[model samples]
Target: MKLLKTDGIVIKKVDHSEADRSLTLFTKNFGKININISGIRKSKKRHLNGADLFGVSNFIFYKKEDYYILSSFELNETFFDLRKDLEKLNISFHILEILNSVLVENETRIGLYKLLLNSFRFLDKNNKPIKNYLLLGYFLLLLIQGEGIMFNINDGLYFDIENSIINDLPTFNKLTEIQKIIISNLFDKKINDIVSLDPSVDDAKSIILLLEDYMNYHLNLKINFKEFF
Candidate 1:
């Protein structure tokens, strides 16, 4: 078995047998990995704390043919603040679910990693208004990386969700001008700097729905977070 060390965020954890766990982790160097973690609940272990949801860790693993065996882990960021509120946990889970479904193995996605880390930081700081911003930003980031959606900044035109660009107006007639501006600004602003700019809850919901349609049309993936709100 080949040994490897990498920084990873715990995406999901499922109880396997009596005392073992199957973890879905998104790593900085290795992308998504399936690792079996053991001896956490039964034995008196100190490092078992590293396996929490949204926990960032320095993981040492042994690569088998298909999956990796978690040998050791050093806890970095437990993101305990996110666990204090149900809303925060729900939002975090939604983001993690999207990443787990979209991102492929062995693909380097530094931008996505940074987005997740920054979102976690914002959640820790209790920045509620910007939650939708981060969510939309991550969706756009994934869309751009996967399909290369092009937009013309100068010419104000309709963005066809099916085509992933501002080419026609007739197809995307349902999208309003403000909605278009919101989508445009999502791509324009830096991920960390995205703010609501005095957006109402209803407006944010509309924008999220439009983005979901755009994503579905382009990437062919249905985001499950839409049902939550």
Candidate 2:
């Protein structure tokens, strides 16, 4: 059998056969995959720290009898500090859950992989606050597109971007128009570029909450969108 190597991040790790572990990895070349990591619990083979959650690594695995067995792995970036903080940890977990829900196993999506990696780095950089809603609105917009969900915005005036398209504008018409532009612009941004936007706290909250609602409607996510707010 031929061995394949790719850069991937661990999404899940589960105990198997006492010594062996089963891991789900989101990879650059293969998208998502399940591989058996043998003898990991034995102290001699414990050097593979890439088996932990959010561990990014270069993995070499070979298929045998239609199942994959990991041969070797070298840790790249564990985002360990991001894991230590409660807020960052929770956001990162939600990101993982969103990715797991939308992607299918063994489907190659290099763009999606890059987006996921950059998002992890952004969280780790501590360049911005975790709950202040940096790039999340834009990220969800891209995730919806990546997952092949179809949607259109008509002359549909949206009073609340989360709820529905409404024709009537409230008394704060100018403010509403500006926010509507913000929501629309989210779809046009690259994942990393979205962090540059500076909106008022009130506007940011509404925009983020609304985007979450929009994603919830389309993806039917198992994780609650409200928790991110």
Candidate 3:
């Protein structure tokens, strides 16, 4: 009935038939939405495809019932660099999955949206080693903060392989005092301005595992961490 315009990232996509595909987008104005692009040309349709996964694009559509009927779109950034590395690709998908799972329809989360875009840009452009568990972990911390959920680094609670979460225990999975301090600093500092630190594989895994549990609990989501690995 009405035309809508917004900038969004393609978080998930599925082929509905040979002629059409559906996109799950995280937009700035609308939190999460599904838009369907119709009338496939078979050979010359990449532009309307919206740059595929993790791609940023501006869309114009008309609202029809529960979905946006895609009329036209302009490709912004496809983040093509992420496709070259499997680990980077997996991490980007995981971050997008977190956003898709935790965010709701028609709810505006500007902070989370910007963080997701910036995180992808950082990953795609930067030449750092694939030690980006901190990037993902910081997003979780920021999400918890944005939703007004109370979280403490020294809460002595974490996820267990056998159970979902453990709370009010002696220590958080044997994290050293210095490691805890570094993590707490991640929460205190701005995400863009923080000095990057090289956390070991074990350390990164622990932080992500802990954050997965924390975010799942707060968001009432049942997603697991094994998917990322």
**What digit string (tens of lDDT, one per residue) describes model 3 on residues 57-148?**
99888887766798788889887788788778888888878777888888888888899999998888766542466677777778777876
Q: How well does candidate 3 match the true structure in TM-score terms?
A: 0.85
- C-alpha RMSD of each candidate structure in angstroms: 2.8, 4.1, 3.6
lDDT of 2 by residue, 152-217 (tens): 544444443333443454422223654666666666664243345555556655666665555666
TM-score rank, highest first? Answer: 3, 1, 2
Reference-based TM-score of each model? 0.85, 0.79, 0.85
lDDT of 2 at 76: 90
Instruction: Pick out the ten consecutive residues of candidate 2 with the lowest summed lDDT.
Output: 166-175
The Cα local distance difference test for each model comes to 0.70, 0.71, 0.72
Alpha carbon RMSD to native, model 3: 3.6
What is the C-alpha RMSD, rounded to one decimal, of candidate 1? 2.8
Residues 113-181 of candidate 1 have per-residue lDDT tens digits of 777787787787775655644565556555555556544433445656655556445554355565555
Candidate 3: segments with Cα more than 4 A from true spot: 41-51, 153-172, 190-197
Backbone clashes under 3 angstroms, per model: 0, 0, 0
